[model samples]
Structures are given as C-alpha cells and as structure tokens.
Target: MRALFLSEPPFHFGVHEPAPDLPSRIQALVDAGDREEAVVLFQREAVGLPDAMIAQFRATDAFAGVVPLAQSTVYDATLARELSTPTDAMLAVDVPVTILCGQQTFPFLSAAAERLAAAMPHAELIISPESIGHRLDAHAATRILAARLA
Candidate 1:
C-alpha cells in the first residue's frame, strides 16, 4: 500500500513512533493536516466541480485518496466512474490483495469482491459478518486480513 492513503511516507514504514500524548494529540493534527492536504490536492486534480461543491470541499480533505490496502469506495457506478475499470485493479499487484468489506456497505462491494477474486486469481474476498466502518476493530480485521494475505 506504500503511502497510497497516507499523506506522509513515514507511517508506511511501520515507524509509527507516536509520542506519549500521540493518541490524544495526533488526531487533531492528522485530521487538520489531512483535511488541508486533501483539499489542495483535490482542487488541483478534480475539475468541473459545481461552485457549491467546491465550497463544500473546501472544509475537509477526508475524500482526498484511498489507501490502496484499505477498504474503499463502494463498488458501483461512482466507483466504476472513479476507477473506470471493469476489472479488479488489485490483480495487477505483485502481492495478493484481500478485500474485507463491511456487510452494511452497498452490496456492490461484496458482489464486486467475489467478481474480483474470480477475475484476479491472486486475490481473496472476505465479507465481514458485521458491518464495517471507519474506526473498525483493527485487531480483528487485522487477523482476517493477515490470514488471507498469508
């Protein structure tokens, strides 16, 4: 995944050397920084936004870009439009990719995961029994992901 969804490169190296107050202090800093960075990048990259849309995007950068290894856009027209790929992009990776989608997300991701696993040959799909979310339980998810990737 490298820095696919990270604003900075350091964290990708497993060097997350957070301070004693890192948990408490980092959120505000990362939130603010990620927001500002995403806005600038999107404004530069995304074009033809309605004025209102632009104004709305001005407030946050949460939509900047997805971390490649992270579960992302629901598989749908928007995702297809964003990716413009009828095929699974994960197939191209040298490393195998495992998609663990939230059960609550639009059904397309689960459907797409199956289709992708079929098409990609090297990938795996695991739909969580429970709905997944932004701050999902990392420990449990990690175990699932690790087993699949292994």
Candidate 2:
C-alpha cells in the first residue's frame, strides 16, 4: 500500500502556528476576477510550492479548470474542520505501507510523512528530490512501487 501525507486523527503535524485564512483570501482573489493571483496565492500559501513549480502548474490543463471559488472555499474550510478529528484506523493497517512525499513540499507534510512511517510497523518513507512542492515524481514513484511489488 502507498500513501501521501497520512496523519492520524487530530492531525497535529506542524509546529505551533496559527493556520492562515487561505480559503477566504483565495475566494476574494477569485471574486475580484484575479484568477491568476488566486492560483499564485493558493500555490504559495496553501501548497507551499516554489515559484518555478507554480509556473509549471499554471500551464497544466488541470489548473485551467480549477474549481469555482465557492466550491473550493467550502472544500478547504471543511477539510480544515475535519482534520481535527481523531481516528485509530490508520494504526490498524497491517500491509506494508510506502509513504511518499516531496522534498520541496510543506515542511509539515514532510514531518507528517516521517512520523507516520515511524509509527507504522511496516511502513517506509521516501522523500523524492525530483518532486516539486506537493507533486510527486511519477517516474520515481513508478520505479519504487514496481520494485516493491516484485
């Protein structure tokens, strides 16, 4: 099995810092018809992606069809609220788990991946240097997963 940024209930990963009001800010940008700025803000603040990665992402078809402001805002808000609840299901998994993360991702994400791998008896953490921000290196992931399966 494989996972990315898995956290048990009450997702406490990062240092003690107040969460930024990202959804509102993004919504405002979108509402103002500054969709490009909204994308930049989302990449920088929410995803912690570097400028180069952000530029590359902006060129993608997925970026062109990013969700509407209202839906995105609601989703982000709900995700924040939901992450606070605790669950023990993750700890019960018995299969070998490969936790993959990008070296350039948010520090908290890397920390969370590390912690999850540490806690899981059959888990391994792989931080791919070729990855950008929260994006995975498809080639590297394919190679690793294939090797594991074999």
Superposed model 1: Cα runs more than 4 Å off: 1-80, 86-90, 133-136, 148-150
Against the unseen true structure, what C-alpha lDDT does each candidate score?
Answer: 0.39, 0.63
Q: How close is candidate 1 to the true structure, as a TM-score?
A: 0.39
Q: Cα miss at 142, model 1 (Å)? A: 1.7
Candidate 2 lDDT over residue span 4-74, tens digit each: 33321223344432245767777777788787787677656654567987788788887777734434643
lDDT of 1 by residue, 29-94 (tens): 335555343333332222223456556645555444332211221122123344433333444654
Q: Please tell me which predicted candidate would have the highest TM-score against the true structure.
A: 2
Instruction: For candidate 2, report its TM-score.
Output: 0.62
Compute the lDDT for candidate 2. Answer: 0.63
